[model samples]
Target: MPPFDQTRFRLPRGARADAVLAGGVFVVVALGAEGQRLSHGEDSAPSQIASWLLIAAVCGTLLFRRRYPVTAGWFTVLGTGAYYLLSDIDGPLVIVPIVALYALAAQGRMQAAIGMAAAMIIGMAAITLAGSSDVTGTAVFMLTGWLVAVVALGSARHSRLAYAEEEARLRATEERLRIARELHDVIGHNISMINVQAGAALFRLKKDPAQAEEALGAIKASSKETLRELRATLGVLRRVDEQAPTAPAPGLARAAELVASAQLAGLPVRIERTGPERSLSAPVDLAAYRIVQESLTNAAKHSGAGQVTIRLAYGDRELALDIEDDGQGSAARPAGSGGGSGITGMTERARALGGELTAGPRPEGGFAVRARLPYGTTGKPMERSDR
Candidate 1:
């Protein structure tokens, strides 16, 4: 059995290929066996006209072989069995059975193909003993060997298709999660800051006009920046023919930008870092940036804190981050609560890199988030100017 048949007569791709090739095989067999065997004298002779018509009927079913493979396969097996029982001719009329069986299995009808295989083997064994004078088991063995090979090849094709489909599904799922995380980082943080600054701008408008103007300016800047990042986030899904932005991807190097936004939103912020500075792997860097972003977002939105401190401490084996806000100490909600994706996204990111994260209210006061991430292969020593 040929695993692939590239020797083509330019038959159109799908069902037409099966029909044309199978029809041609039937015609060739018919021409080669011009007449039936004159065995057991004229009394037992098979009619030439009847044999040709039976072969035509079986070959015609192959037209729908691809669309209704199981039905076509069964029809071919039954027709071939009838031909063996009735005809006194013996030639390569078995090619139609082989093609039908392959179609059924290659289309993932394993049970149907196996059933046809069993029927073919049984029919051949019975036909060997009844049609020929040779009582030896040689004919039965030979027929079984060839049919088994054809069935196996078709089954292998089915398995390969199944594996490919499963792989595609996994990639699609991963892409969806990646997009979700980007949205949570880009939209959530900026929206929170805008909400705060807009509220402050309105509250202080009459009492302190200059302070109100500053808050309004911060709101405008925050909104514009949000829109820019939103565009960058969505650019990932653009088609090949569409134009996409060429902005650098956000990571730990951009942490200071996040702090500046927080300050503009009327939340005083301080940063402390104690480390031999190094570069980080892309996934780890993005995760680090997102975790810090989401944490600051939560403080500005719900913490009710005036001051927030962000501490970054690096060691030989691990990197540690601590974000604390002197807020209402878990009075509002948990980090990822209120249908928010903040804590969920951060947790997934940390676990993916064999790291861990935790967030809760400190015993004395305020809310704190701590994350410890492995340096692993994702980090390397770099110059201070790299940032």
Candidate 2:
């Protein structure tokens, strides 16, 4: 058994075509019926039979109007016109063409459909006027009804197409955002650590060979971590049908791993939890993890910083992450510094999810990164006076 698709509700094109073809046949029969009745000039059996056959053929074509709407409309119009001109049938013969015209307006090209409708109205008026009968009521009813049907159905089709296109665009946008978030979580974290350790290694290479080697080892480790993460994220971007080795990317639960890695790279990382220890929403947790990772990276880059403390606090409505490093605080740094691309990217990530991020040096001495996210309306605050 195949999975049911809720979206597949449209009438098949072929089915509509068949219906239109049937309608064209009916138009011819209907005209013949009116001709026979007029020839007899009385309520005769032969005339009645001809009219019934014609009505059946024209009505049958109604089923296929959607599939070959234009063709059916044109045929009905021609057949109806011929019937009226040859048979002297009254207003009822006009109904077939009016119906076909409406179908055309609903599904055919707008300019052409409108033109056909105009022609039908004009032809009907000429016939009625030439016959010198009071046809204003019938003409108005037929033309108005056809125009309304066309406008309504055409507008519906246009709206449906627009909605489908919008949905497709939104899905694409979401996929891109998801990929970007994953990349920031993976490569951004590793690059920060690697850049810091490499800078430290270069500084120590000539002065202290042993320290240089240690820093170099840290750089290698960070590079490997970055590469692993990059590979995993890219794999997620691959098509499902494409064969590739897949690895899961780290989420918030891997904060301990990130902290351990930072510690190994000569940065002392202290992880503190102030909120009731509980699992967080995936997005919130991912955001919290990235904030800490970025702060640790900044610590390694700016100065020979040690003792970095990361605190996670959860309140009833919001989740807060704070990263503090004992590096040169805001006072130690020059003004107009540190608002680089990395900070800009981090800010974008937080704001995209309706979160807020603030970064500055602590007054006491060191840099601080803080992010607040509204995860859900539940959770106890982790009580911490000094983190």
Candidate 3:
């Protein structure tokens, strides 16, 4: 059968014995006929015809060998036994019994294979004794070796399929865990900020009317912003299997909106842009935006500071962004208690984009958060030493 044809039948280890037995029987008859045509020996036609008929019966039984291997193999042994009894010691049909036994061993039922093998040995011995045949000892050893090879090959194929299936399952499990982690990192901080804003709105609603209205407005705005970002990040994860989303993901380009949100939250902020603004890699842009957003958020929560400075500068090999707050500066500021993973998450985001983050109290009594992200836009920022 041709390889790659899905529908083609294969001879299993049990069935292959029958195929060899059938095919060997035919070849024996053909060899006998050729011997007679060459007139090298005096062979009787009736005996030759009987031998051919015996082979046909053995070959015909092979069709049922896969279904009834025991029956087919028994019939094959019986026919070979009878042929050995009738035929004389010669070159033509001498190899048929050994070949049939091999076939039975390769493709017959286990008990049937053993029984056929025993019968083949006994029959060949009987013929050798009665007719003084040559090569009788060689046939017995060849049959035993063929059986072991077929079983080993089939078991190996089974083992390979099992291993491949197990590996695929593990890969799928690891992929799911990775997706869960990314979701937690992307959505966790934003949701917490929303909760904080909403809680403040509810607490101030009764005693301070104007302050309560402002807090409620901030909550609404924060919720809307959180929903929008969640949708975008979810969209990114969903299209990861195919293509990145057609719409560009939000990044440093949205820094103005971030500053406005901080301003609305009653944090006085000054923003300065240096060097010509240009597009950056998506990962770098996203990380820069997150660093600025989170830094501003922390300043509003922990430091009762009125003034914050955000500076963006594009350099030849890197982009530098700094968000410094002149608030009650200290390393122990409680922005969101100890449960905050925001700073850690921001650092990870920057590192993922091949950038660095530095956040600590500045020596001059303020908290300074700086991130330097490499840029490759063919031009450098205007060189000057200005603070």
Candidate 4:
């Protein structure tokens, strides 16, 4: 035998599913009523037919349960009562109203569902007490328990769905922020370099033709590099079925490239290492590289600095970065103080990986950005005093 696919039996929402549910309820209740009529043989043919019609009417109300939940619930409750009062045959027709009660609660009509359920239970209890109904007290108690359970289940499902939607919305917001930071870092750094080179080329066009030619060449190279990085960043947003990019992401291994670009923009940059080098996690490596790139760009554009120094320190648990420049120090614009997001973006990147970054003008007369990033696993973010 083939394996069964349970999904095939799962009813979809809408009129078709409602019709199927109501039809199934009618068939079940009719069969039970017929069985009772045959076994008792007390109801006349006309009376039995009336009972079947009443059962069908009550079950049919379920077809509109999702569209007008409160209205359908009341209809089924009153119809079931009429079926008991007019028919001689006893059956399981009360289930239709129970299904409608659950639908009402699931649609967030809790007050109406509870009201209908209370009315049904009280009316049934009154008829039984008056010596006109055959339903036992125990049956009424069990029915009350079932109604409560169904309403509770519906409310729980609603809460779960709401939580899932909120979580998905939060994830989407975080992804957009990450993408924005990447674009700012990649495009901003290169464009600033190109602008500086263009200005230099224009200033020396006639007085120093060779120097002007070199500046123009640097501008062309920077522009080409900008396009490549931009394409790589945008590729991440493409659909899964599309071909993915093959280029590696920028990391500390490309620190030399940033140095060369900074030099072309007329800022001298030197890299110094203090400890043995070791491979870093992708996130940490990228964060470190971007911090360096942004710092160098700032030095070239804003800081009247003669030289910039980048120092890397490797330890057993963390990698530390120090980028300082012999610039105008406190006289220069502070990081992120000029409405630029470079410093803010760099700080966000570091903190996201359980790291800490601080950028400030040094008391000794230069600007410095310092950061410490951990390896694979997340650790407590170090405090400023610890740094």
Per-prediction TM-score to the true structure, in the order listed: 0.86, 0.64, 0.49, 0.84
- Can you tell me which runs of candidate 3 are displaced by over 4 Å? 1-186, 199-208, 232-248, 330-340, 376-387
Candidate 1 vs candidate 3, lDDT winner: 1
CA-only RMSD, every prediction: 4.7, 7.0, 10.8, 5.0
- In candidate 3, which residue pairs clash? 13-106, 13-107, 14-107, 14-108, 15-107, 17-103, 17-107
Whole-model lDDT values for every prediction: 0.81, 0.67, 0.65, 0.84
Q: lDDT score of model 3?
A: 0.65
What digit string (tens of lDDT, one per residue) describes model 2 on residues 15-130? 66565555564656556655756675765555455545555655665675766777766766666665455434442655666666645554536665676677777776786777
27-96 per-residue lDDT for model 1 (tens digits): 8777655544433334243465666777887888888776777888899888877776666676457778
Judged by TM-score relative to the true structure, which candidate is superior, 1 or 4?
1
> Sorted by TM-score, highest first, which candidate order results?
1, 4, 2, 3
Model 1: residues >4 Å from true position, as ranges?
1-11, 27-46, 134-136, 240-247, 335-340, 376-378, 385-387
Residue ranges of candidate 4 with Cα displaced over 4 Å: 1-13, 42-50, 131-133, 240-246, 328-340, 377-387
Q: Give the best candidate by TM-score.
A: 1
Residue 313's lDDT within candidate 1 is 83
